[model samples]
Target: MAYCKYHPLTASTYHCESCQINQCDHCVDDDPEHPEPRCFVCAGAVDSLGATDIAPFWRRLDRAFHYPMNKQTMMLIFIASLLASLGAFIGGITGFCLSLIVTAITTKYSFLCLQRTTDGGVTAPDMNEAFSGGFKIILHIIFILIGISLMIVGVERLFGGLASVLFSIFWMVCLPAVFINYARFEQIGPAINPIEIGRLVFTLGGAYLLLLLFIAIMIASVGTLHQILEEQVYFFSAILQSIVSYYYLIVIFHLMGYLIFQKQKILGFTSRLESSEHSAGRSSQNRMLANIDVLTKEGQFDGACATFKQGLQAFPTSYELHSRFFDFLYGLNKLDEIDAFWPTYLDLVGRQGRENQASTAYQRLLLLDKHYQPTSPDVRYRIAQACFEAGKSVLVVKLLNGLHRDDPQYKALIPAYELMAKALDDLPNKREQAEKLRRMMRQLAHHST
Candidate 1:
């Protein structure tokens, strides 16, 4: 599976064939006029991604190894392949079944990871996900293979025929496209249907041909290495050959899938590829925020809010809309408004690791201004933690005191004493007081048990 070249944790939402890199939704630029999004590095449409716009393919060939699939996961897969190979040597029903099942499981699992990566998630799938699409993934491949087998059987022996050669060439060229469709939709109908398959190939045009050429070379190279290893006649060499072969098979599969993701706009699959929210252009966002600021200074809070809401309606994923509105509300002491839109406040700085700012927002909601109050234990604990981190031990104590008064056995208050002790311990004359609070924390812990 291909992950975002920028953030390894996040899966890729789109492939910028222009910059020759994968990007998550946060990094992609969608201008609404195009179905496929261009990355921030590419200034124009996805179609404008020409050879001059990207790095050489040879330099970027190492990106398949740059996936989020960690060494431990790949190591586990290698070990599984080793076991399956050993089992196949037994030559019975058990061995045959194990070999087929292991191959199916590994391929399905790899495809699941690819799908998840393109969907903009971060984590590589665990082993159980290999069984998720289950027999369906294997079945699609089997169906296509069966069809090819039938075609070759019917035509290969016919009178030194041109038809046999033509069919063989057709199957070879269309095989990658067939698997690409199957991987995306999980249906044999989509894979084997000639019209559907042909449309995808033509829509993708030279790109599909280039991808096929690349896959052919990639597999031939890996397979040639495996052939040399097998000729070495060593057990360890054979095991390593299996590992290399299957590993590159999955890599080629991902390359094919990324081709689809990059060309999804023309293929009408952009809805699946695009993120849930479409972000507006930066200039459009700047203009919207500027107008909102004008309305706010003119004492039209409702108009400012309405304009902000409309802009967000148009561009739900606009970070500036969220953060600028948060700052505007904060500047006006609009505590109720800020509290109402707390999620936007959190999302504004989500990618920036702004825990201190989040704590500050919680402080404003819980303590800074007394107008708006949240009355949940979870809320209060969050407020106390944020206040503690903000270095407001007094407010932390006040919030904890309220919780303790309401429920004398409130175990969460123990952390309040812990925070208080840490803050006091840093001061010159407060060591004894800090120790006293530590004792109180211990007493609470002991009594709670």
Candidate 2:
């Protein structure tokens, strides 16, 4: 949740270890040609800050449960479960192979869920994507499972039952990491590598422990439910178990995905959420603003001015663009240019009902050139009205003092006189003048009638 160094309002998702500064996604160089993100400041590879913007898996259990409740996911689960149930009903070596195929297919979908979720795509993927390439992950998972079983059996034979029990428990705890690693690299070697699994688990730390706790609870719950169904209704219990297993598979994979999302920076994966946020920050106005900042810093004032002018043209109503340009002009001491820009900026802010901005801009222009005044009668009146409301009685009187001489045909003359009269009434010795102004207002109203 660290804010970007350049734009304080935006959150940073990448950091430069060399510069020790956090950057928003859009502020860094994300060239597709270079897989790693490069820093805009030093062109060095940046570290991901990870999915700090998203909630942790433990905290989002409701979402995890509902993730597979979508129509497509439900349909997939039902169909897969029915196939597996049919395989069980067939009851032979052929039936066993059929069931294995169904298991592999479902496991593939579950792996797909984990992969997509890790990439910040929380929604269940289309059925087609799930079926397309999940068979490979199933093979990797089988290898991992077989490897764990053999290692446990070897430990029991060499070091006795206690050692085997400990090894079994260790592998049980490392199961999630094993699957996560496989999903990340999509390779059997890395998925089964002890170092890779340990690194991921260590990085996840307490959150991983929490994940294990949830997994244990889910497993126990599912087992108890299966037992209850088996005892009460022997006929449909297998089908029910298949349905429940598929549902929980989606949920667990989704939870794993969220875990990766929350730590994607450490995991070195860009998430859908991060990509989308970066894209959003690259709007034309923002790009222009960034360019202007760069041009100004490089001492290219003319080019910066040109870019700033183009930004104003492209996004005339952008308050940030106008404000930044005004500050830039003020910094350069370009009083003449600022004077030229002030009226348009003031009118724009006023039309947007920004009374404070209009008032502040006028006051700043006045300080730069005491004789400065907005030529438009409406702009002058609006500023005066704002001043009066802000209790700047003297400034209001100065602003409206000779309205008739300046613009005798100004439309809002009655309101101007009324505001002037109110300001005068607030002064100590101007009570008589205020009374005279009120009489003038009444005379003007009567004449208009």
Q: Give the number of the best model, judged by TM-score.
A: 2
The TM-score measured for candidate 1 stands at 0.50
Instruction: Give per-residue CA lDDT, model 1, range 213-310, as digits (tens).
Output: 87778678877887677667565775777776667666666566556555554555443422244454346666556556545654778888888888
Instruction: State residue 311's C-alpha deviation in candidate 1, in Å.
Output: 18
In model 2, the Cα lDDT at residue 296 comes to 68
Instruction: For candidate 2, list the clashing residue pairs, or say none.
Output: none
- Model 2, position 99, has a per-residue lDDT of 84
In candidate 2 the C-alpha lDDT for residue 82 amounts to: 82
> Which stretches of model 1 miss by more than 4 angstroms?
1-61, 117-123, 152-160, 231-233, 271-449
Candidate 1 displacement at residue 67 in angstroms: 1.7
130, model 1: CA deviation in Å? Answer: 0.3
Off by over 4 Å in 2: 1-4, 7-12, 15-22, 26-56, 89-98, 153-166, 191-206, 231-239, 260-276, 286-306, 323-334, 346-360, 367-371, 374-449
In angstroms, how far off is 52's CA in candidate 2? Answer: 5.0
What lDDT is obtained when candidate 1 is compared to the true structure?
0.64
